[model samples]
Target chain A: MGNENRIVNGLLKLHIALCLLFIFAPIAGSFVFSLNSDRFPSLPLGEFSTEWYRLIWEDPLVWQGFANTVVVGLTVAVIATLLGFGGAYTDFRYNFTGKSFYLALAMLPPTIPVVIMGLAMLAFLSRVNLSGTTISVIIAHGVMCSPFAMAIIRLRLSQMDPDLEAASWNMGGNQWQTLRYVIIPFAKPAIFAALFITMAVSFDEFAVAWFVSGLNETLPVKILGFLQGQVSPRINAIGSLAFLSSMTLIILAQLLLRSPEDKKS
Target chain B: MKVNAEMEQQSEAIVKFDNVVKRFGNFTAVEKADFEIGRGEFLAIMGSSGCGKTTTLRMLAGLEDPTEGAIYLDGEKVNGKATWDRDTPMVWQSLALFPFLTVQENVEFALKMRGVGKEERRQRAEKWLEKMQITEFANRNINQLSGGQKQRVALARALVTEPKILLLDEPLSALDAHLKVRMQAVLSNLQKDLGITFVYVTHSMSEAFSMADRVVIMSRGQIEQIGTPEEIYREPYNRFVAEFLGSANIFDSVITGPSGSDGWKVDFEGGETSLSKDELPNAVQGQAVTFIVSAENMQLSAPDSGQPGILASVAGEEFIGGTAMVFLETETGHELKVQKSHDELSLLNLHAGSKVIVHWAPESCHILPGENL
Candidate 1:
């Protein structure tokens, strides 16, 4: 039995190693490829060069795409976080008719196909004369990102004790004051997490942005257009850079919103 | 009982509940609760779970508003006033400290909300934390503190506001027994030192009896009785209050004879006794009543004593904490619990299945007028 247990432990260690390689191999490979002088994918490392990154940066179209991504990402992050927080607070604190229905509606956007949601929004916006505009793309991205924020914020709110809010009210804090001092501070971490995810989703969005972005070009759309015409070391460099930036933001967001429970020890 | 002019002129009770009714659909949480909390008085509302005691505290805290009637704070009608405007602070059961903030920050938030300057808030927070004996933890996160330490921080946080009244909802229920006793003393002294009116809610009889000047016993959304601890324990108004307070040997009785000046001669199946003054005072002749006698007041004797009172046979005996619980079965097959002090145990020397007589003085029998025997 002891020998069998040792064999199981050995297999478990091997399995973990394989899993780590499977996860990190692609990211490491991309980082290495972005520096390779060759434009084609190859295993042998070539002379490291930033020429690809420099070329991508100097491209006017690429810069325009980057600017579009920033605007769309920020707008979606702010709008989605606000909507998500409001939905979570309402679901947690009060009981009303059709509350479950409202919660399901809040979750519907992220669960449905992005193409379908984009098409529905495109149809609605066309009727309202809002199609083919930057505002339309921002709103569409916000819609797609909101459900993610709402789910995260709701989980955080549910874990918190309801009595905390009541305690604030009893301590002579009005409704707004309790929300400001108690609920907001306790939810800051989840709020930051929601913002990070929302920004990432809007920045990397393709399916929905391709439909409604008439004159506007988000980086993902612009990148797809460039890929259709050619493949290069520059594309790989931009992909590597985008992947790193998203990872850094997510890590920083999680740190900023660290749970006090984790630090008690 | 002496009333000073200033106190009398401060006719405004710190907290008052006047015919307030709160209902969650068909179930009534608090049914027309009429209560008044005096300034500087420590009052406890106690009951079993689902008895609406916590609901009553919530209504007073303005966390939950009553469906009917009004609440007043310091003579002003505050039924519609926000909790912050009422100036009543609550110490929550879970402590509910802001886990992300330092202990000092949690305590100072109230003062900051009231627009106190940062420097003054810091000084006040430190002083309160010192009084709570948790000054060392002022810079530590609340999650880092022990249960008792967190409790003290919660108290400091609530008290720093220095409101006219404070509401505590089972503040010490989560502490270990030793810590509970220690914090009870601290809280009792704190209330006395600060002169703040305390409206506490708890289910522990010892917690209520040890700290409260007055207690309101609730059952099923209605106030069963409200009195001092001694009065509620010794002279409970009904069988519920009597049994809720402590152990009692209730005898099924009836007023078979004529009424006396104080009460009447209540006759049980295997006993006859005169009722005390507080119970069944208006009992008419031949009126049915149930007499309740405390276990400590009962005397167990050998059957041959011929005391011309209740007679029973010893059912069993068990040595409980600091007391001998003698169980006796009366002639009608009713069991009675008699508590004998350790000093008195040597005199009785009780044994199970032995014949004995269970008797009490006429004054010890409280005859309650009720249908359920």
Candidate 2:
């Protein structure tokens, strides 16, 4: 029995190590490759240089892509968080007819293929003369990211004691007040989580933005364009920089949203 | 006497229910609940689960509106009023203290929603926190508090609003037995000091008996009886109330003779017993009836000890420190529970298969209308 237990533990540790290597090796490689002075990004004895970083920093196209990414990411984050919080709160607190169907509809976009969802939104938006615009790209990204926000928000809402909302109402808090005070306060961590995931997803969103944005190219689309047109060390520099910023944002988001109870520990 | 006094106080009731029938879909949660809660009345709605005691409290709190009839508060028709507009607050069974908010913030929430100035709200919250004896913990988040402290925070939150009526739904049910007793004292004292009406809903007779000024006993969503705790214990209206209250031994009985100047003899399960005219004022010969004998009132004598009593064998015994519950099976196959002090049971030397005699005074047993179990 002891031998079997040891073997099982050993295998589990090996599996974990392999998974970590699979995820981080490429990111680490890209970081190292971006620094290698060789134009072809090759082997051992190469002088580390900041040429690619400085090149991308001086490139106007790269700067435009970065600016577009921030704009689209921020817009998608705010809109998706609001939509997701409202959807989750209503689902948790109400008992009206057809509620199940509405929630299922809210979850439909994420469950279906993103390519199909993107194409469908493009077609529908075009019928309304809304396709191929910056706002359309923003809306499409919000749609792509909201399921994640809603899922986390729902998990948090379900963990909440429903009696608190009832207590609020019983204490002379109107519906809006209860939502503003009790429900929103309880949902703060989840809302921040929504923002973090939505922002990340929107920044990285490619298929939907590529299909929907006719003129306004998002950062990922513009990068894809650059890569398709010509491969450069500048791409690696941009990728590494984006990875650093995303990780920083994720960590900062987590610290800001940490529960008071968790902070005690 | 209590009923008359309550009747006089009804005209000035702070809250009144008029033929209220609340239903959820096809199920009726509260059936024709008609009662008046006087100013500063500590009323308790009590029953087992799904008996609609909590549903009644919810309706009064305006969380659940009555599907039929109207509810009036302070003589204003409030049937369509939202929960917040009613100025009624509730302490939930789970406490439901805002886990993220600090203790003072949770208490100050109602004041904040009411647009009270920040300084005033803080001062009021601090005053309540101090009165609840949780002042030191006011700055701490809710999850950091103990169960007793959480209960106090819930109380402070509900009371800080200073509403005319405060509703509580089994507030002490989650506490440990010892803590429940102590919180009961704290809540009762708080209600008295505040002079605010508290409609407490609980399933525990001890809680209602110890804290409530009057209790409404319910069964299957209908009011069984409403009276003082002493009145309820001494005069339960039906078999349900008697059994639900606790430790009652009941038997089927039939009137055996016409009324005389003294009393009437009735054929009980195994033996004949006489009930006073006062005990069964409307009973006639051969009419089936039901009667209740409390566990404590059941006197056990030895077989052929020269006292007239029903013969039964001791089936089991449970020793609960100060008192012991002696289980017996009568000749007619009826179960009788007799509770006596340990000393008394020891004197009788009660053991399984020991034959014993059970008897009670005519007036000690309350006669109720017969119903099939």
Candidate 3:
């Protein structure tokens, strides 16, 4: 029995390692090639160089795309987290008819096909004269990212004792005061986690931004432009940079998601 | 003079429920609750879960609005008043201490909501922290404190506002047996020292009887009886209260006729007994009645001793601290309980299946007043 268990465990570990390798190998290849002094990504021991990094660093278009992405990401994070917190608190505090329907609708956007969502958003934005701008990209990204924020915050709220809010009111805190003091403080960590995760989601989003943004293209759209015009190692460099930033945001969010007591220990 | 004093006491009631009824959808949570909590009285509302004890407390706290009638706080009709508008603070069963806040901050929260100045808030909160004997842990997070310390913090937080009345919902139900006793003392002393009316809701009889000056017993959304613990224990209002207390043996009987000049004769399933006229006033012959004999009043004798008692076999024994409870089953299948000291039990040489005679004096039996034929 012990030998059979050892064999099963060993096979499970190997399977997990293989899955991770398959997922990360392409990204690792891009990171490695972004530093090689080769025009083509054929890896036959080219000298390690920073040429692609310098090229992307000096490009005005690259700078514009990066700036737009940062602005859009931050604004989308704040907007989405506010909406998410409201949606989550409604689910937490009240039990009215059609509540389940409301929650299902709130959580329905992300599950929609991105292509269909992009098309619908483009149609809506164009009719409202909001398309072809950074604001349009942000609006589209916010619509897609709010559900992620809501899910994270909702999980945290479920862990709260239902009596905490009532206890606050019993102690003379009005509705708004209880929200500001009790509910918000208890959910502070999740709120921060939601912000970071939504920002990362917005940062990495491309399909919706591509459809809505005409001239004010975000980083991902600009990379697509680079890919179409020419196969360049600079795209690898930009991809590596974007991947690094998204990973950092996700890691920060994971840290915030840990209980405060866990941090002290 | 006594009438005038009684009127004054009635006017001094800190909280009053005036025929209040609360229903959620089709289910009635509280049914026509009419009671008054006097100034500085520690009143406990007790029942098993779903008995509306907590519902009654919640209605008083303004957390749940009564569907009918009104609630008054300190001579003011507080119907539809938000809980935040009332000065009634509650210590929750879950403690519900803010996990993110330090002990001092948790204590200061009520004052902060009331818009007290920063300096005064700190001073007042610190005073309560010291009063609760948790001043040293003031800066520590709530989760860092032990359960007893957290309980003290919860008390301190609720009391910082100096409300006229404090509500507690089984706040000690989570503690161990030893700690529960200690906290009971803490709460009892705190209520006396503060001299504020306290409305406590609990299902534990020991907690309610030990700490409360008066208790309101509820069952199935209705108040069974409200009296001092001793009064309710010695003379329960009905069969429900007797069974709920679980320390008395109840029997169904009917008044046969007058036993003598001053006593009436009654017949039960087990045997016949005589009750003094004072015990069953206005007794009608052939009217069904229910009476209870408390466990402590019962006696156990050897079956062969020719005692005038119900013959029974020992069912079991339960040890409760310094005393033991001997349970017996009569030949007619009526279960009876007798509480005695271990030494007394040892002298009787009782065990499971041992034949014994269960008997109680006629004066020891009290007829339930609420029973109807």
lDDT of 2 by residue, B1-373 (tens): 9878765555579888999999988999999999989899899999999999998988888888899998888877888788888788888999888777888989998899889999999999999999999999988978888999999999999889788899998999999999999999998898899998999999999899999999999989999999999988887778888888777887778888954677888888799777777766776788787878889999999886989989999999887779988999998899999999988888888789999999998778777542522
Q: Which candidate number maximizes TM-score?
A: 3
Give all TM-scores, in the order shown: 0.91, 0.94, 0.96
Worst lDDT window (10 residues) for model 3 chain B?
B3-12
Weakest ten-residue segment in model 1 chain B by summed lDDT: B364-373
Candidate DockQ values, in order, are: 0.66, 0.73, 0.74
Q: Work out how many backbone clashes candidate 2 has.
A: 0
Native contacts present in candidate 3, fraction? 0.85
Q: Model 2 residue A54 lDDT?
A: 94
Between candidates 1 and 2, which one is better according to lDDT?
A: 2
Worst 10 residues of 2 chain B by lDDT: B364-373
* lDDT tens digits by residue: candidate 2, A196-217: 8789888877888889988788
Count clashing residue pairs per candidate: 0, 0, 0
Candidate 1 C-alpha lDDT tens digits along B179-257? 9999999989989999889999999999999999999999999998888999888767787887787688767777776
Q: What is the TM-score ranking, best to worst?
A: 3, 2, 1
What range of 10 consecutive residues in model 3 chain A has the weakest lDDT sum? A256-265
* Model with the higher lDDT, candidate 1 or 3: 3
lDDT (Cα, tens digit) per residue for candidate 3, span A1-265: 9999999999999999999999999999999999999899994959999999999999999999999999999999999999999999999999999999999999999999999999999999999999998899989999999999999999999999999999889888999999999899888889999999999999899999999999999999999999999999999899999999999999999999976444344
Model 3 C-alpha lDDT per residue in residues B1-373, reported as the tens digit of each score: 9979756756799888899898999999889899899999999999999999998888889899999988888878898999999999999999999887889999999999999999999999999999999999998987788889999999999999999899999999899999999999999999999999999999999999998999999998999999999999999999999999999999998889989888878888878887778866777899887888899999888878888888889999999999999888888888889999999899889989989888889899888898843
